[model samples]
Target: MAFTTVPLTALGAAPWEPNTTYQTGDIVTYGTDTYQCVQGHTSLVGWEPPNVPALWSKQSSPADTQPPTAPADVIASNVTSSTVTLTWTASTDNVGVTGYDVYNGSAVAGSSATTSYTVTGLSASTAYTFTVKAKDAAGNVSAASAPVNVTTGAPVVDTEPPTAPNNLTAPTVTTSSVSLSWTASTDNIGVAGYDIYNGTTLAGSSNTTFYTVTGLTANTSYTFTVKAKDAAGNVSTASNALTVTTLPQNSTQYEIIGYFPSWAAYDSPSFTPSNIDSSKVTVINYAFLDICWNGRHGNPSQSPDNPNPNTWTCQNGDGTVNNAPNGSIVLGDSFTDGTADGGYNQLVKMRQLKNTNPNLKLFASVGGWTWSNQFSNTANDPVTRGNFATSAVNFLRQYQFDGIDIDWEYPNSIGVPCASGQTCQRTADKANYVLLLQTLRQALDTAGQQDGKHYYITIASSANSSFLADAGGTSNWLSNAAQYLDWINIMTYDYYGPWDAASGIVSPLYNDPANTNGNSQFNINSTVTNYLNKGLPANKLTIGEPFYGYGWKGCNAGPNNNGLYQSCSGEATGGSDGSTYDFAYMQNTGLLSADSTGKYTIAGQGYTRYWNSVTQTPFLYNPSTKIFITYDDEQSVHLKNEFIKTKGLRGAMFWELNADRNRTLQSIVSNDLPH
Candidate 1:
């Protein structure tokens, strides 16, 4: 080997040259072998990697020669519009897996020390494919995990606005509020709600077509518009503008309410609106409007030969006629095109009567004893309640009514027979009745905003415990329903009638202790006291006096206790409807008269009049004829009027407008009660 001293370069190994520094763990090749530096040193001529065993050592075979196996069970979850989380089973490496590399279509999207990674900043509404790779300390990555596919969600975008509402109008306008309504708007999405604008400023909003914009200046003119909006924040153009001027505040003290039965226009001794003495009463309630099973407002169809043309004629669901009379009367004015009948024509005549008495207000009373069968159904659901309210508004506007009166007789109790496929009672009727009143109040308020006037609502309440308990469960119905109503007409009469086997005073101001077989709480005084004790404000209560009287024949007659609470063989004779006679009929026919002592006397009619000081009511007895008449005469009416003022009640109401032909009783009410 010493023959020529050949250089290490000739042996095919790079020569270790002088002046080249090497650091620890530096790898180099010499004489077909790889070596690593053990210490920092400069190269020498004879100290080659092969010759210097103590200073250099050949690098051993490479460790971790195999890369990790492909990750298993890769999944993408928790995906959102802009982000997704990825997870995978741990990969197996020849050594051990240290970390993971997440990829998006072969490009490194992210890295993770564990098996899961959350990738963010992803495009919305875009499709994407992802994978996972495993790497060891040697930096040898495995193949991508089974290709996983995903797509980001679409972006939330709102571009369409609701259409402009049409027919913007006000139903009622008051000193401080305007009731507005319009046709609802349309949208690609659903219209969420509406905003009412008063001269370009938002005054209120409503989910429905109706809205009441309050807090306005009294006696001021206001311009209003409506705008429709969607959930996406888009809004439509403003609706047509409407201008309204509010009315001055009302300062009336007393309320004199009268009932005008639509059928009265067609009945014998026909009492039309022309007969109404406007100065005798400040308000007239038109009776009545009915609800059909289909949620439409209905009244009796006019029949030329029905005698009472306004009387309702019952119709089956199939449109077939029935023997039962239709108990509802549609106002003749409800029809357009000159087809209006005497009923509607009478209503028009009444509406015009307001010009003579500017303080007079008229309302349409809906639901009565015979037509109340559908009240429970109408008020049980929101849809039906809405329909009923809309129809009520339409009816009021069409007839120029000043308000509405809901006369649902004895809710949660039986009235007349229900129409076919109709429900008359429910346990929920109490609460639903309140809801019905609330709906009507809201609708009425909205309507009142447009008309520039205050609208009123009243209820004809029963005078018994059953009516209260059934309506609100120990809570006074007046307490629950009074705020929405202008007044409650308490039917203080009707304590006893032919419905009772024994006769009693029809309307006693106080309890009668004379051999009583009836309820002690049935009299007017007890009824009013009960209501007042149960949280009814005296000012909101109007005592109801019957213009008619209940008659019983074949009863014991005496000066003591008269025929009160006496055994009656049957109903009295000579009543058009049987068992009842109007004040007019009694006086005109000389069945009742006033004695010299200012007491009502049976006088030459084979009847004797007796006064019950304890009950403060009068009854007529006929010993030979065995007839008894219980009624309120002018003296009794005067006494009741004094009682109203003493008790600080609002006023009094009569069951009818046509009953007192001579206004004998009305004269007392008009003069005795506060005007």
Candidate 2:
């Protein structure tokens, strides 16, 4: 019997074929079992037949055939300084080739049983070549694969941050505030954010290039530094520090808003009394007697309803007035004294006031609690409004007033008197009010050329939230007024009083818990915030602090209300029930005192109380008399002063000079004004 035939040529470089029959010594019958040779080895397995050739002729023709065509198409990718990976098509073998050998620059780099190899420890920035070959157990080496060369890149050095930003500039500058902004910085690794520093101290940080430094002292010197950061947390050295000195805040000029009786000139001995130091007094608001709708004939003492020029007097020194007497006048009448006719004496008095206090300013104020009704009508009509503007400038010229102040109780809104009429209420009042201001501004500018004066226009508005909301007027009105005027005065003091028909906290800096949302009703922060939110500039806002207190008859007088005024349960006290007194009257009465806790309290109407630390305001109540009064004092004013400093708002204002002629409140303003 003959065994399967053996082919020696087929076992050259291909995978070896093993014998499936016979394990250790299985029966080796002829034609039943076959024998085969392993790769690179001339050894036979199973039983060898007699016809089969034993010890086949050994072919010595380079057992490895050029490494199976040089392991076609070798490639190297994802190269690095530390390691280089190489891949290639598997080498072909006639018989069975166990593994492959990789070469680096013609040298054996590594050996693997698979088709891939990783060559490591090569210097960076250096070039390397890799090739693969087949290897057999007989120590046969096949032809080398096509060489693939790879050059590693140099090591990376991240030593710089993003380029410095551009267009760095100061947006706002105040005694204690400096706002700055700049273009963004860009970097290769991405920017993180920016850091702002005051001198060496880290003032603040922002993800943007804009930054604001707050809580600074006014008129002080400061240094600022800016730095840039990258995503990797790499920070650039701080930029050159910039040194700046805050500007001084000045309230040297004042524009009064109120009525000045036509007899103001003749009554200089009393009404025109000069109690205030001309040098110290900035502005004055005088109530009008007959310079508005009725013109010279509008005197209540004369016609009361019709124009009455017969008794209409002015400060002009003719036969009815004198220079010194008329000069006592500061602000003009709260009437639209027509430019063509009216208030020649008022104009004369204004010139006298300017001559007396060279720095003193006069304002031709228009509209009063009663006359404001015409504001809606005049403000809405372009012709009427234009006439009002012309009258305003003419009054300024005729009276030599420095500016104009509008006390139009409110446009399209009600105050003091809630009666509704065509002029009483109008939906277009708000927009019309703005239009009125614009028209006045144009007229004032037009008149400015001839008079050589810029008529500063201001408005006396209500201090109630209802007034603020109804007319869509806000503290921002001050900033808007800045376009035509100089300052916006917020009547912050009127937050209290018996006008509400309910006894409550007065001049509370914060909201009253009993009144929950009541805090929003009247507050310095609220009023100022309202204006700021409306885009009003802080420097243009002037906070109004009352120099007097409101007396009320109510119940509940204890620690909360302060044991001062009496608290009773009865019909509300007549608004006139409480004697109106200015800061002077309070100081003169020796009612100016601060508690151990730094709270202010007034013993008005046999009641004593101070400010609440929690509420930041003053209160008064009497147990026996059952009376209550709320007002402001030094302590409370101090808090407001600090707030103004914090918020970077303009200076403050007093209801009237007579309220603080003793310089009590004046000293406070003198101390707190920016400079």
Candidate 3:
């Protein structure tokens, strides 16, 4: 009876349902296609008929054969040693442009659903010609776009070799390995490496002048020569050979963990993945991946802030809703973690160069001070915790990270309360924190087992002992969770800032006697001791230092200890935040300088820099403006490194690689740590 008024069936195929398995030749209609299943499989959002041709075949050719107009204004950007990112104006079609195909010469280099595409697997120092063509849903292709030529980068042909290494000496000799050191060699385009030879045979190589040659006979004498080499493979004459007898075996390398923030890539004169010198760091913690909930992310205390920003979505990398389980981790900023040319891709590029930096482990640092709001919710429940763990493993595998760093602000209690008296913290966070880590550890182990790669886990903790203890609510939860972590990044700075009414050290190596205020117990030494006393191993702790400083204003000079612990009338609200400034910013703003004696001072800004004997920190006090800044210099940074060794702690961790000036602090770290 209903057949009289029924409309004709289109393709006579029903839509595919999620998780529904279909046999080969089974038909389903979705979007513009009546697709026949070519492979028996269940359906998922990303596996739609149009997306996976191996599983489903389009049943008919497009009715509209008219192609889209050729794409215009082809442009290439973010070209690297092996990757070229392309962008072009959209093409018009009588129906519509379903996608675009990018061509390298005559071959199809890549395809994209949008106008932009990244042509990867290119060669270094090579030229590539790329053309883009538009396509309609009917598979009709448009004419090729105007070709864009892109050239990759690197040190060009170098006939000149690096200066020969000098003063070669055996620092430590073992039964199987000999640790050798020598004066660094000079190069025309920066020394790429040093080749160490046993007699006439190449035994091993090192990026640094120092390297440990292994696999020698025990108690045997070996003669070794060192030659400087450049990126162009040009090698210098061998140095005077040195002979040494082997002893018993031994080795150790303190982790030089540097926090490489995703936001750092957004800086002008940006630092990308290629900019990362693997030799400088043992571990790079890529920071602030967030937990998605309520479809919003927390802001880092900035205003006019996220408006018109990039990568603000809580979606997966493809700009699709994660649609995974609840409380899972998502890319913090997909724009910065772009599909082609952003930090995420850059990190992956770095990962692809594993052979170049065999020891450089990149860890994804999640839930920084601001974005940690959702962590409590994610960790509190088993379902969310399960989702968090699996999502984290997927992200690690997807992004090619070697580890994960949990930076939950005040895990269960006691820090960074939300605005207007809102509380993101929960009492349940204490026990849940350990469970969360346990889940992560198990998941990491399972994934690592499947891939035969060991993935690490770490926690970024407050350097304050009280915060560490108070967080657990008498349970000492952190100690319980330590068994699952590779190390703890103790944020040994931010003890005091402009936020404090009184001017104090930014991060003191020892407790400041003048710190009579609330955070009086804060200091690097006490924080490390607290962990040790709580039965946490010192070797599993990394002292987190700052590559930045904190400033306080309306301060008093003379007898006020040059603004140390001086009562500040106000704060230095002129920086990125009200209190923080990078070491570069201080010098750039002329707030820090050198005097006639080559001593660092703020005298140009009417301020005198002073060093605190008790805190082992530097401070700047302006008599006129009454501005006070407590910052770390090379001397202070070195002192902290010495502290790391003195306490037998794991290593040194900096708040950022971005804040270092001229790699000054970085060089200090390399020199200070056990090579």
Q: Pick the candidate with the highest lDDT.
A: 3
Tens-digit lDDT string for candidate 2 (57-81): 1122233333233577788877865
Estimate the TM-score for candidate 1: 0.60
lDDT of 3 at 631: 84
lDDT of candidate 3 over 1-675, digit per residue (tens): 111211113334687655565655577878765776644555544566654443555563425768889999999998867788899999998865646788999998855655687777788899889999987644688999999999997635679998889999875454555657788899867787889999999876666555656556667889999999886789999998899988743225688988877655545566666666668789988876887653544442212221111113366655566544446787765545555222245555657546677878988888776577667767766666888889888988887788999888776653555432123567667677887887777677667758878678899988766556645354666766765677788898888877778887889888766667646568888878888888676767899889898878888664754766778877687654456778767767777675675445444567677788888878777777778888897778889988888887778888787787456678878888865
- What shift in Å separates residue 333 of candidate 1 from its native position after superposition? 10
**Candidate 1 lDDT, tens digit per residue, 557-619?**
644646767888888856545678888888877777767875456555777777778777777
* lDDT (Cα, 0-100) at 456 in candidate 1: 86
Can you tell me which runs of candidate 1 are displaced by over 4 Å? 1-252, 295-344, 419-421, 470-477, 558-561, 595-602
Report the Cα lDDT for residue 37, model 1.
56
> What's the lDDT of the predicted structure labeled candidate 3?
0.72
lDDT of each: 0.70, 0.53, 0.72
User: How far is 269's C-alpha from truth in model 2 (Å)?
Assistant: 9.9
